[model samples]
Target: MNRTDLTAVVADATGLTTHQAAEAVAATLAGIARGMAEEGSVALPGFGTFERRARAARTGRNPQTGEPIEIAASVAPAFKPAAALRRQVAAGRPAEN
Candidate 1:
């Protein structure tokens, strides 16, 4: 499901209008980003932890030309699902809180 579907679900669950749900969803994502920028990570209980991962510069093979190319170092966002989340996904329903 996409953003619109998610917004609808939020609206149904919270009795909010679709527009309000959309704003909430957007704000939630923005908050995560801001948290990551300032703190390098965000943790949500029973859901997951989002963190920044750093990659070292390295040489990569050019698949088409079979030549080596330099790969730049970078920091990327990563997620590790909480045990509750993993169990919920495995069981096809949310786990008992």
Candidate 2:
């Protein structure tokens, strides 16, 4: 679901107004981003971990021309689900710690 749907769910669950829930969602997203930027990762127990993945500079092929080219180093964001989350998804049932 999108942000609006998530906001609605949060609002209903927490008895918060729509605007408050929306702000909370936005703030949570911002915090995640900030954490990623500053620390390169964030971990939530029973949920998952978000991290940075790095690729080194290297030579790569130009697919169309079959020519070799340089590929710049890069850092990318990634996520790995916790075992609990994976189990929950796989079994379609609540995950037990």
Candidate 3:
């Protein structure tokens, strides 16, 4: 599914209009982004934790040119799904294959 599908689901569950649901979803995502930027992490019980990770500088080969390139360090967002969510997704399937 996609954003529209998600909006529909949330709207149905919350008794909200599609537009309102979409806006609420957007606002929630924006809030999460802002929190991650400022606090480096956001934890939602039963959902997951979104956190920042620091990537060290490294040398990488250029696939096209076969030349080495220096990769600068950076901070990146990471997500670790809650155990309950993981189990829910894994039911009747492999966990993390």
TM-score of each: 0.94, 0.84, 0.92
What is the lDDT of every predicted structure here? 0.94, 0.92, 0.91
- Rank candidates by lDDT, best first: 1, 2, 3
Q: What is the C-alpha RMSD of each candidate to the true structure, in Å?
A: 1.3, 2.2, 4.1
Task: Put down candidate 1 lDDT per residue, 30-63, tens digits, no spaces.
Answer: 9999998899999998899999999999999999
Candidate 3, 3-36: lDDT as tens digits: 9988998899899999999999999999999999
Candidate ranking under TM-score, highest first, comes to: 1, 3, 2
Error of 1 at 75 (Å): 0.3
Q: Candidate 1, clashing residue pairs?
A: none
- Residue lDDT tens for model 2, 1-97: 7999999988998999999999999999898888998999999988999888899999999999999999999998899999889989999885563
Name the 10 consecutive residues with the lowest summed lDDT in model 3: 88-97
Error of 3 at 23 (Å): 0.7
Any runs in candidate 3 off by more than 4 Å, and if so which?
92-97
Number of the predicted model whose lDDT against the real structure is largest: 1
